[model samples]
Each structure stands twice: as C-alpha cells, then as structure tokens.
Target: MENNMNGQTAIVTGAAGGIGSAVVTKFIESGVNVVAVDLYQQALDVLIEEVGTSGGEIVPLAGDVTDPLLAIRAVELSRSKFGGLDILVNNAGMGSDMVPLWEIDLETWRRDIEVNLTSQFMMLKAVIPGMIEQGYGRIVNTASAAGMEGHALSSPYAAAKGGVIAMTKAVGKELATKGVLVNAIAPALIGSGMLDQPWFDEKTKKQLLERIPMGRVGEPTEVAEMITFLASPSLSFSTGAVFDLSGGRATY
Candidate 1:
C-alpha cells in the first residue's frame, strides 16, 4: 500500500479533471511532489488549494498542453522545485464530434492526434533524458477502449489512442534496459465528465454502457489506483504493456 515515493516528483497532465485529480490526490497521499498541469490557471489553483501542502507540495503549471514549450516548462519546474522527475502521467485528452471518417476534416483529425498523441510524445522526449540520467522512471499514458475496439463514430480519437498504445509499446522497448518502465491504460465508459462531452448522446451512452458487462461506468479512483501503481518505483519487470481498466468491456 505504501509506495515510499515521498521524495519523488511527478508531472501529471490533465491534472484538473476527474481521473487526473484522483491520480494527483493519490500521488500527494503517497507523499510525492507534483507539478500539476492543465489548461486553466484557475482550475489548477482550485486543485492546489484543495490539496494544500499538508501531504506534499503541488506546483501548478497552466498552459496549452499541445504547445511543445509547455513540456519544457513542466520538466524544468519538476527539476527546480522537487529535485528530479520520476513519473509522468500523459492523461490529458479530448474528443467531441461524432462524425465519421469521411465527414472529418484534416484540421480536426490533426488536432485530435496532436492533443491525444503528439503532446505525449513531446513530453516523453523532454523527460526521458533526465530519467535515463537518473536511472529510474515511470510513465503511464491514458489510452481508450475506443482505440482497441475502434468505435464507429470516433475515428480520430480511436486512431490517436491507438497511436498512443503503439508509441508506448515502441518507446517502452527502446528504454526497457534503461530502468524506465512505460505503459498505457485502456478504459471503457468511465463515469467522468467525459460522459457529458457533446458527442455522447443518450442513445450512444446507453449503447456504450450495454457493451460493458458490468452495466455501469467505472469510477475515476479505480483508474487512479492503477496509474499510481504504474508510476511506482517498485514496478521493475513490466514495461511497454497495456493495462485494461475496462469494467468487463475489454477481455483482451
């Protein structure tokens, strides 16, 4: 239960959302210093205030995660504030339109890929060298069940997450012997504000729920628990693997 991660530092993107916040909370509870990243400074402020400094110090970095410079700033913050970075949670992502592939424009498609996949790549590029030098690191990326099953109307999102899965696998192997562990989690129908995203109409929501044999959406905390494990220093043997967080929606 105790990860002994008190002095470790982490950068968690999407740190203001349901699952992101839960992971941040769990990290703080484990005594890990956090550089919380998200879009809005106000939201980051609220999260920092809510968490306080009782467990561990949390520094907020608000910016567009898609901006490549944000990655540099975040890593710099981690190093300057907490000594060195030990973990990365690439959990920020978004998709809303329900258009089919043909109906999708190039800009929208590229945007989805940029937000869901490329930004994570930038982060990995920025953080990996430090981790390699320090000789220890953990990275947990948030993929989606849509990526694996290829849901009908969410092609770009599925493609991006699928890319994330593949990228994680490739990079994980690239650094397998370097003492860094990389992994992705694929979750289906999580009961977060994502359910409220414009694309998930009532019919779509019902159909999605029906696909999960558990007949309900997953809690954010459940996802957070697994993310925390992947970020732990104790996870030495596993790397470049995808972990399922689906509630019976993913049997593969």
Candidate 2:
C-alpha cells in the first residue's frame, strides 16, 4: 500500500494471469517499475496498454517462463529498461488434470515438474547473482496449498509444488546471510483461471471450497498483498518461510 519503491525494478513471471496481474498492479502502485513476462503475447500487450496509462514504466515480454534463457533475458530487460532488478516473483505454473497418480501419463507428469518446479529454479539461478552483487534482493515463489496437503487426484501437481516449497526454504537458507531473502506462498483455491480446466467440474470446485474455513474463494489481490510485503525491505526477520493464504484452513 505504501509507495516505498520509488526507483526499484521487479520481474513478474506469468504477468498476464490472474494472480500475476494483481502482483504487477500492486508493484506499480508502490512505485516499482515492472517487467511483466507471460507466454500470451496478446494478454501481455493488453496488460501493458492498461498499466502504461498509469504513468509508471511497464515493459511486457512475451515468452515462456520455463525456458532457461528467458530468465536471463528477463533480468537483462529489467536492467536495461529500469536500471536493475530488486524483486523476482516466480508465479508462472500449471496444474494437471484431476487424474489418479496411476492414470497420469509420463509426459504430463514431466511437464508439471518443468513448469511448476524447474522453471523457478532456473529463474532464481539467473537472478541471484545480481542480488548478491547489490547486497539486497527479494524472491517470492508461488506454491500451492496442494503442495503442503497433497491434493487428491493431482499427484503430479502436488509433487511439483511440494518441490517448490522445499526449494524455497533451501534457497532462502542458502542466501540468508547474503542480503537476499527467498520465500514461498502457499495458496488454496483462489479464484484464478486455473479452475477453468475441464477437470474442475462444479462438484470438484465445491468440494475444494468446502474445505476452507472461510467458505469462500480468495482473491488474487489478497495474495498479491502478502507478496508485496515479503518483497519489501521491511521483511527482514523472515526468510525460508511458508506464508499461508488458506483462509484458516491451515492450522500448522
């Protein structure tokens, strides 16, 4: 809510998606320049047009987050456009169908890991050096509630996200003394387009919502707020932590 980032730059992957778009907006409101990346060119264009009118600098790059080279390109774009990178939000990921572990194909399983897990690893590898050089950085990875609880009939997605959570903690600890903080956010059933998958029938959606104590789906802006806080210099005491956005569904 505070415009503390008067000159900082941020890289937000999946910047055209529901949660990613909210994060882009949040950073912009806080006076941070944004390099929005997404696979959808048209969507990124729309986002750039909409946000460009707000009087802040926004550079939209259409690319696959899973590509190893794109990570470097994104960081370079930030440096070339806005001077340097201060925050990296690895929010690009996909969820597989609601099929049992035994029923999932090998290719789909591999894709899940590539998109949801390995991509974040690549981004962190590309961005950490600059952070270390500057002696300050904030990294936020998007993990799902399924990562922690292991959702039924979504083993591949769960496994990949679980890996993300673990990776976040490992990286966070590795860089705790380097002035760069890394953390992960585990969100439940947020009202994102991921629910538009054919596997998410009305019954499936209802069942997932019923598990939340709040009895409602979360908004992308709510998750973005948590991300903004973690990305700020104010978050000094916490690193390698999992912030829950489960609406009282998580007791641990």
Score every model by TM-score: 0.98, 0.97
Shift in Å, residue 159, candidate 1? 0.2
Residue pairs with clashing backbones, model 2: none
Each candidate: what lDDT?
0.91, 0.90
RMSD of 1: 0.9
Location of the lowest summed lDDT over 10 successive residues in candidate 2: 48-57
Give stretches of model 2 more than 4 Å off.
Answer: none
lDDT of 1 at 168: 92
Question: Per-residue lDDT for 111 in model 1?
Answer: 95
lDDT for residue 177 in candidate 2, whole number 0-100: 98
lDDT of 2 by residue, 86-132 (tens): 99999999987798899999999999999999999999999999999
For residues 67-181, could you state the per-residue lDDT of candidate 1 as single tens digits?
9999999999999898899999999999859988999999999999999999999999999999999899999999999888888989999999999999999999999999999
* TM-score of model 2 vs. true structure: 0.97
Cα error, candidate 1, residue 147 (Å): 1.2
Best by TM-score: 1
Full-model lDDT, candidate 1: 0.91
